[model samples]
Target: MKRVTGIGGIFIKARDTDALREWYSRHLGLDIADWGGVAFRWNDDNPGAVGTTVWSLFKADSAYFAPSDAPFMVNYRVADLHALLAALRDEGCNVIDRTDESEYGKFGWVVDPEGNKIELWQPPEGQ
Candidate 1:
């Protein structure tokens, strides 16, 4: 099975979320949104193929990256969430049992050996 296709997003915990966001917006020209993130749209080599990679900031104490205690979490795009997650579980990876699905995509979690929480995302059709 093909594993990670690409990076879906990069999330960082911030002591001062607003300040950091503004700094990134003003200095780095990130175009941060009201939700404190930006979606960078791009195209694949395939004609008309488009996708988005997100960059977002979370509060310092947010439990979003829970179970690993990491300050950052990386979301990897996958072709098939259920299949890959099953394979990870079968391979003895620390795959989190919980999964979520929404308009955006299907989501799952896994923890790396170094205790960093990893998010697996399969974007909605045509994304």
Candidate 2:
């Protein structure tokens, strides 16, 4: 069970998502997309690298990072979201009882000991 393989994304909560996105773009040189985030492809540095690392901003009022009042959330790439989630549940981890699937792939969540929500992602095939 190779748990977390890499970071899928880093999400930050801000009072104003648009302003924050602009700041990140202007100051950090991030190419924020119209979708409100940047996807850093991996193959550029490692030929075998697959998937991307996403950086996005969310409004502070957004409930996406709910159940935990943290201002940030970290999404981690996983080889098997279902299996890993099950393992976490069996281990008494605070695994959320929900899962999502779309063109993006399967997604699940858990709250760390410090109450920070952690996202687990399994990228779509060929990603």
Weakest 10 consecutive residues of candidate 2 by summed lDDT: 42-51
**lDDT, model 2:** 0.91
The digit string of per-residue lDDT tens for model 1 on 35-83 reads: 8799999877545678989999999999999997888999999999999
Q: Each candidate's lDDT (Cα)?
A: 0.93, 0.91
Global CA lDDT of candidate 1, please?
0.93
Cα error, residue 33 of model 2, in Å, equals: 0.8
Model 2 residue 104 distance off true place after TM-score fit, in angstroms: 0.3
Clashing pairs in 2: none
TM-score, structure 2 vs. true: 0.93
